[model samples]
Target chain A: MDFRINDEQRQMRETAQEFFEDREVLERARERIDGEDVVDDLWDDLSEMDYPALTVPLEHGGLGDDVLYLSLLLEEAGRVALPAPLPETLAFGAFVLDELGSDAQKEQFLPAIADGDQRLSFALYESGQESLPRDIQLAATPTDDGYRLDGTKTLVPFGEQVDTIVVAARTGSGTGMDGVSLFLVDAERVDSEPQDTLDRTRPAAKLHFDDFEIGENALLGTEGEAGPTLQKAMDRYTVATCAMTVGAASRAVEMSSDYGSQREQFDKPIGQFQAVKHRIADMWMATQAARSLTYYAAWALENDEPDAARAVSEAKLFCSEQLTQVFADDIHNHGGMGFTSEHDGHIYFKQAKAWETFLGTPTEHLDRIADSHEL
Target chain B: MDFEYTEDQERFRQELREWLRENLPDGWQAGERPGTDDPEENVEFLLDWQRTLNDGGWAGLHWPEEYGGADASLLEQVIYNQETARVDAPARINAVGIDFVGPTLMELGTDEQKERFLPKIISGEELWCQGYSEPDAGSDLASLSLSAERNGDEFLLNGQKVWTSYAHVADWCFLLTRTDDSGPKHHGITVFLVDMDQEGIQTEPIHQITDETDFNEVFFDDAVAREEHIVGEIDEGWEVAMTLSAFEHSMSDVFSIEQRWRSLVEFCQEHERDGTPLAEHTHVRRELARLHTRIQAGKLTHYRNVSKQMETGVPGPEGSMDKVFNNQTEKKLENFARRLLGANNALWTDGPDDGQWVTDLLMPYGKMIAGGTKDVQRNIIAERVLGLPKDD
Candidate 1:
């Protein structure tokens, strides 16, 4: 078995990493820490590079790379703390549409997304979820033409001002998971107010769907059967976010190592002190572990491994917990500058904390794993 | 990028699996290997098992073919390790001879040394221990005072080595001796192949916290090592010693870690707290999940190390990463299990499966110390891997 990435993946990683580095995505991220503002140039550059089409099938006017490829791009974005819903609009959104969308839906949407004319947002959370497959309180009552959606989806990332919104809602009757359906709605049909999220670098919103009407074509996949499809979509999202978190943590580790080598209080570099050196070493170790698990999870999901969902949850739990610690220790390594508002360290720190809570916390994923693996 | 083994490797894995199925001594299960309670019986059982492996041409698979090995490719060696660890086959009692002494001999030993020593190592007729660490040279190994003076056709060896695993049972030792005191400490050392049966050699078993005496303090009072037994040139022992230690650092039995973790998960599922399965508890679930994730990551890291080794033709600092991370994870897992067991943790030999958890819990401290201390590993990462400034 080989753990090394193939030449194609290596090229993809280099391209993505170089784009972020040359664009100074870190500075751009720093400029919009207080709010979510998509830098037009950065988005255009990504679009020009066909990043949004990363998950689309080659037959459908896009790059045909799998979840592993998308994960690399997201990780690069995460390393620079790029304040965008690339994972939402590109990785997760494109995946759901490609797998579950009809020909009409794909025809109507996929090209604009590929060309950067449209951005897709996902509305999956209703209120706050203590567990996954949470009771979908959002109701999608069938109408003569299509369906009318009512209820709110909290934590709808990039919820405001998106071209299309794919939402998870209960259609027919039963409680959990069953009768759950995914619908693509025009962004203008719903009301979205930006929420003061923990990481303003990537803003989230509370979406209010009050009699939001959608056409018959909006229904993604089979109505009640959308549960498994949605679960798969969420798994992809979890792995993508985990890959990003891994990137962010490694960046934190890199910055901390640099700081440790340069910063000194005594006769020697502070890195020479065991306490400082070991703590940074610990962060580095955790970051490597997170990266390995994330890559494995991506591989498993792409290859349809038997334990795919378990692997996804494992990556989510590991990367979330590890990135949080790495970011925290990174701040400690930076001393006073890390505590200040101006330093890029806090941006990574906040993004890490945000990502930890973003799909699910480590504790939540742990519970999910317990159920899945029957631990 | 592929995680699955090649077809040939898979076939080899199946072959080994079938061989193990037919040949493994009865009552052996993954994660249920016997300890050092009955050293002689354990030795006998292990030697017999090693002979079986040798008979099957599976012994020392990584060694060159001329030295009584299969001369398997790196992938085959990895698959062999993975499969053997999966079956919990009795660990080869001659592991020190095979993994450490034999490899060093292949690199630096005279042709006669290889012919004399390599066959017995694979045949399980001889066992070896490493004699690098002294009582005062635990982390600062170069400061070791174990001295040997050159004599005609021999070296008169004298001094002490501590924490030498299997020394009490080993038939020979790859020893580090300070041959000259005039120059730099690291410059004056030599490595010798010392016969354990010789006079003027004494071994005092050191009972570890596990209540086992696999480790010992070996004293050499004018012990004789023939000139032909010296590995590499004299005054270059430091480099020779580093070779074996590097192997030890990278070669963790990670599949066994996976097996133990699976058993722990089963334990968490079978036992309950507050009328719910212990795994159902959020805190317990979190701990178990953490353990599971690290084990998975450690397993993959081993693969990454192997991949890096294949590319570089030598193991890199990445092995130290595996060594540090795996040891730390084991320590955390053991501590977590101990707490989860609570009062039951004290039931050594009275608990489940004859107190295996108790032993497993106490066993990782040695791992942290062996190869090199965790601090030394961190130093290696800092200095060698990360290119950080070294201490004055």
Candidate 2:
């Protein structure tokens, strides 16, 4: 019944923290937000540390670590608002491939992904759609050699840069979850345009697949059977996002605390004021709770627990809603400085806003949970 | 970071479950109030239930073996709490004695004191109430004016203690009194193991919003407290009081919250709204799911606190965090239950589940105020946990 992370997990987290700090990842994130090309080098540095390979199986030329390891590393990434496709690649890309990809598909892409030579993104949600299987409207018509993809995938993270995109499209006549299938499509085959998102640190794109042709070998798992696989992948992604929120929100609270201690108005540290102090305290409490739920969800997923799906939804719901409040309170605590662009507070604030609605909003996850419990 | 129980712990849980199944009152339903609706009868029933638990060796789980306890591990204690909550078992009648007074005594009591008081506390022979808060010194406990003037081998106690839960039925009290006033308010205080059955002691029950008299105002006029009964050093009982308060706040209430949530979910499932299952309503489902997530997060927070305590051998400020979270979460759940019940929420005996939901809604108000108000807990977290400066 121990809830403490093992020594290895702790060490990995510490190393990642140190690496992120030494690299000045937050400063680079700001530069990226200002339209600088910092992601490539940052991605390379992360690759050098083999972070992208953390979740890839050893048989697939990687560390074979579980989702907990990825969550720990992503938490560090989130602290600095790392502007990379790490979550898309490791959390969604590698996980889905390993879980449902064929031996041939795993042999083809897993090693490239592990080595950081290839980038991957997921195109799950279409226009005005949440991450529900029933919301998918992309079509994959059968062809002589393969399938022709047609539809648009909105909010595809790193869509313009990733080498491959895992597309969830309808392949059969069934509705909702029955007819959905995953296809590993070449990024060049799709028309991708980067969209201006609230979280500029992590760029997203709108992908247009106009009769994009792919061979039979591009199919991931069995056709018309990607419903459960995609759902599981989305849950994993949601948990990973929760881990990131814990990091970003904790950092925001720390910053606000420091600011309150130093920035004074009444001939004393503002932190001494109960109004400010209590707000920060509340933020800290929420952040701690979010972290606990996130870690538990990651553990449940890694261990294949029976309540894994429910746990993931719970974590996502709490992290998304509570962290947004934490960030808002943090900005309020900082007063005018928090409103300035020069301050890093707004960066986390925007990140929280983006995350609050990404993958699934709090309301959406609540519905998912209610459905799972048959309530 | 594992949440799975060990084989031995699982076996312990199974044994406790079996014992409960075989021993609980026949036709007992989970969360059902035991005995009659009469408050005094309810107390008696609870006392008997505690005795039954003690006879089965299920009382005082965290106390040392020599003190008539199992000397259980922290996780086992958590399991004990969780499993008991699962069955909605009757709360121990001697909670104040076991949770606050007994631990404080074990830490600060003299050998004679421990030997004389600890066993009875565990066996429910001597129910205890804490005497820290006065009418004027509720949150500012150090400002209490209950004086204990020295008179030979005993101290003559005077003044009053307010909001002393279980005082009306308590056999003894762990009291704090100002022994000297020549120094600061926090100084010159002393903690005494005072017998409540003596003369010159009067208890007036305070009616609560829930229509229950679970606490009282205890007045002491020339009440006697033996000099040898002092639990700690004279003029330094503030720290002792703080220790007792910490024990009060360190408990995890997530299990009970989860229990209430499970029952509410069942209600939602079985009940109907306009010819449809209440659970099928979008708003009801969303609210239920939201509350369920908070409860799950609260439980994890508690486990994290226990894990931290196990590693450091000392509870941290996270206890206050859990305290605030639990209170707020329960308050929210009870509020939601009331809303769900609608007009039936106002009904007493004629309402759903005999109007238990109304009681549930009204009960958590005192909890939020007791054991340190949620605001006071926020102050603790701000100062101790966040390292924020104290307010001027």
Candidate 3:
């Protein structure tokens, strides 16, 4: 069996890279983080290319590319450290809508998503309960016709700017996984403020859904039946984030290797030393391994493998750990300048750290792997 | 890309699997080998097994059909390895000959050399060991100082070859020695197909940390190698050596690694500590999961290298990638097994699987050093693959 991507996937990857490169994505990312809430031109370009419809089925006015293609797109977004809501809008937003949204919901929202007429974000984690979404404290109380959403979701991607959000909230009595439900709510009804995250390239915000109300049609699936669907979406998100991590770590490795060749010490390039060479080698190997498993997880999700969750969790855990190590080694490869803000080292490292715990920590995923497989 | 094997490859896999099931020495999966308790008998038994493999046309899979090999495609080779590993079959006694000598000879051997040696090597009638590493040259293999002097139709060889695996049982050796000491150290070297039973050759077994004597130091004092036995041009053996080393990093034994992992998991399943099965411990479970995941990635990494090998017919720095990844994964797996087994890991024969864990734990450091030290792999990656400056 071959592990290399086919020609189409390679073309997709190259196109994504060329687009991002032409747009000066990373440079613009830095500006968007501190200066503006969004980059409209970049968003419009992505939508025009139908990037958001990648995972949606062909019947839904989308490309019907599998999770593998989506992974490649996210990977490109990561390589540039693009400060946008791509993952939120494409991976979490689009895939969840495709999988769990009824036909009417798909027709009403997917075209807007595909055309860049609307933006969507995900709100999963609550304050102090970052390890598991089972403890989602966002309450959705039953009303005459629909439900009222209250409580805060910390660390929501693009929480302040998106118009629509797919939110996870507690609907039943107990706080276990079964009581959780997902709903699409209007972002205007919530109070949002950007949080100061270590990764400034991709800004996150704290969203407070204070008594936000939505009709029954806003429920993603049957009432209180959104648990498994939410889980499926979260698993895809984990794998997608891992794809991004691989991209960032890979770029970090490339940058370090480039710098090592040009920089010199002891009358020779520092990279000539066995110490520096081996560390750089280790970084490359780690990124390769991380990338391999990330793609494997994407394949598993696309194939609907019975072990998809396990594979996704494994990928997330392994890639997170490897990416963190790669970032640290990359920094070390740069010497004193690595620690300074002048180099790109800190940017990738901070982004790596931010995504390390985006969905869950490596430890949390390890726990899931063990618990799910009953190992 | 699809991970599933094609139907034809799957059929080949089934045939190989059935053959292994029908022909493996009884109780092989229990870590039992023929004559495990007697060293001489073990050698003889392994030789017999190698010959048996030849009879079944399962030897030298990458060699040409004229040499009695199937000339299997890369995918078939991978499938064969995976199947052999699934059943934990005995390792071929002539692995050095099959994996290295035959392939290199195909690329560089004279027609006469191939006619005289390839059949015997593939048939397991003559076993070969590598005589590359020396007491002075380990990681820096090119600086090897083994000297060879031309004497009529014979070359007199003199030097010490250390860490020569299977030297004691080998009938032949592919050795490197200096034919001319006038130029750069790498130049003036020649590779010879030396008869191990020659009058001037002496092999003394060297016991490793696990107290096994698979490695040896072969002293050659005027040892005779026929002049016609040179595999490539004299003083240019470095290219031949590099080719052989590239084959070493192919990592066809990934399935063997998977087997070891399976054994470790079963061990944890059966053993208990603190009034619970070891597998029940959260820390143990976490480590197990991590090791499993890393091995999965390692296998894919191997496949990636194989895919490149298929297209290019030559290995690249990505070979070093596989080397580092496999080396680290093996070390981590063995270390985790050791820690999980605790005091029981110290047992030589009374412990689980006849005390394999102790030996397995101690054996992986050599993996890091063999074929090329981990340091050399990193250097190759940095310089050749990443285009970094050479070491000063």
Candidate 4:
């Protein structure tokens, strides 16, 4: 019943935060501010910590932790604004492999992530569309053994660093929420180019899968039932992204509040003014509510609630909407200094702007909510 | 984190739901109180029903059992409201006493106050009306200027309380009076339980746009109040009224909101515009689904608050969040009803077409504007919840 994070979560949060504090999540985040492909070092650290095996069963040499832990890890990655997609690799690697890829896929891919030897990513979201299922434009035609992955997956965050990718490719018709299946492909075969993005922390690439070949083991799950599995992966990713937004926005609000107090105006602390005070107050409430819901969503994910998708939507809705508002209000409350490129406010602001479209926009969530249960 | 009610709680909900289902008294769909529809028949029916509730030991769920109260659990209280609202339950016949005065008395009332007043409220013998907002004071409640000069054991009261809901129907007024002219504004107010039958007390019914004279302007012209009639401490009434207002808004939000959501759904289910039920259309379905999702989210938040109360013994400020969320949802639900029902939503009738669509749509917009406006809630959230600076 309690909304506050438990001691275990606090411990996990500290571990995750401390992990990122030690290194950039992906080398490319810091390197790619000027470079094309990000060289990731934090992945080794994450692999050392076994984050890639985060949700694998205890027998798998990875922590059998649930989405709650993953969400906390996501928050830290978000707080540090890292680029690795620890959640995607860990989640897609574990969930898809376990659910659809058969035992061999699990044995081959999970240990690499669990032992920190290799990483995995999911090529789900298509160009200009947020939905993984409803917006299934990618085609996956089958060959003698496995399927050929085609169509473009734009904005694949940290797609280049991974050893493997689980791509959602259409095997049949029924384009709405059906007609989609996932394929696991070794990235060496694809001729992909990393796309430049405003968010330096998360490097993304436009994956050009010109009829890429994958083995029969590459079909992660049921041949045509990729929609539901990708959805499950998205549940992990959305919650992860939301957790990140919560922590980052929370820090931004904190930084903004402290600045308001010490940085005075009109012969008094600027925060003493009601308008400034009220704006910060709004940010604080928004952050708290958003954080509460994100953790709750995480708990739901861990609990295996059927309503996890809705929780994902709720977390994304609150986090995305509130993060943008908090950053905007934070910047405004700090006044002129908030706009300086050197200031952290602008960094958080740009991050928030970029994230506003990452998983989905607020309207998309509202539309998703419109489709969930109550209706 | 779990939204499921306990087995016992579920059973209790079922039992009450069954009872209310069987006891769906007519004439409530038009939003008219049964007693108002036909005072003799309605009052007799309502009082008898209250007696039955009292006999079942279901009266005053939040009240301690000492004074005819049920001492119910959080889930029990919610279940009672949900079941009661589900069947409409004859408009409670005595909501003023049950929801407002009873909760206020439980919080700040002395033993004597609780003993003397609670049983009557529980038994539905005496109705109560709130006298906090004045002609000049609404959201700026502390600036209320009602005067109460002490004359020996009695206080001579003089002031006008406007927008007093159900003043014409209530037997007593829980009035707020300025006890001290010398002290600061908030510190000098005192809460009094004044009999509406007192000398120099005038009640003038104020007709609303709904053509209802339910609200009244209660005036006190040197109205007398005995020393024992004061509900709480002398010159400390503002705190009591604040507590009461908080309880009022919170209770209204939990039960009334669910009622609004259901009406919207049922309206959508039955509504038609282009020779089809509105629920059949994609946009309409999406709108309904969105509202449903928000309702579930709000329910989760409400359940969290319920859990907090179950452990902590008090509802927190998240009640404000509940109100803010529900207020807009209620409006949106109503708006959706209008869009779906169209011309059918425009007519308010006691017949089959009784303004079920129209009244349900228009009724609650004022709940947000009237109580503590949504702007105040946003401010409360900013300063209290969000740690925002005051706007001054």
TM per prediction: 0.95, 0.97, 0.97, 0.86
Q: Mind giving the per-residue lDDT tens digits that candidate 1 earns over A1-375?
A: 888877888888888899888878888777666453655566787887888777777777877788887888788888888766688876678888888889988887887777787788888888676454656768999999998999988888778747788888888786777898899988776788888877777777788878788888999998866888778888888888888888888788788888888988876788888898888878888888888888899899999999898788888888777778888898898899989886677877777777777667777777777777665
Off by over 4 Å in 2: B30-36, B245-250
lDDT of candidate 1 over B1-392, digit per residue (tens): 77988889889999999989988877685435654568777777887888998999888878878777887877788787778777667777787888888988988889999889988999988888989899888889999889898778888998999999888888989999999889988899999898999888999999889887788999999999988888999899889987765542236657777777777788878898778988777788777777887888888878877877777677777777888888878888888888877688778888776777777888888888888888988888877877677877
Q: Across residues A34-131, which tens digit of lDDT does each residue of candidate 2 receive?
A: 87878678879988999888899999999999888788888888899988888889889998899888899999899998898878999887874555
In the predicted model 3, the residue pairs found to clash are none
Following a full C-alpha superposition, what root-mean-square deviation does model 3 have from the true structure?
1.9
Off by over 4 Å in 1: A34-36, B29-37, B245-250, B266-286, B339-342
In the range A129-163, model 4's lDDT, one tens digit per residue, is 65546777788888998777778987776788777
Error of 4 at B301 (Å): 2.0
- Give model 2's clash tally: 0
- Residues forming the 10-long window of minimal summed lDDT in candidate 3 chain B: B245-254
Interface RMSD of 1: 1.6
Minimum summed lDDT over a 10-residue window in model 1 chain A is located at: A32-41
Evaluated at residue B286, the lDDT of candidate 3 is 89
The lDDT, on a scale of 0 to 1, for candidate 3 is 0.82
The alpha-carbon RMSD over the true interface for every model, in angstroms, is 1.6, 0.8, 1.2, 4.0
User: Given candidate 1, what's the lDDT at residue A346?
Assistant: 80
Q: Which ten residues in a row have the lowest lDDT in candidate 2 chain B?
A: B242-251
What C-alpha lDDT, on a 0 to 100 scale, does residue A39 get in candidate 3?
54
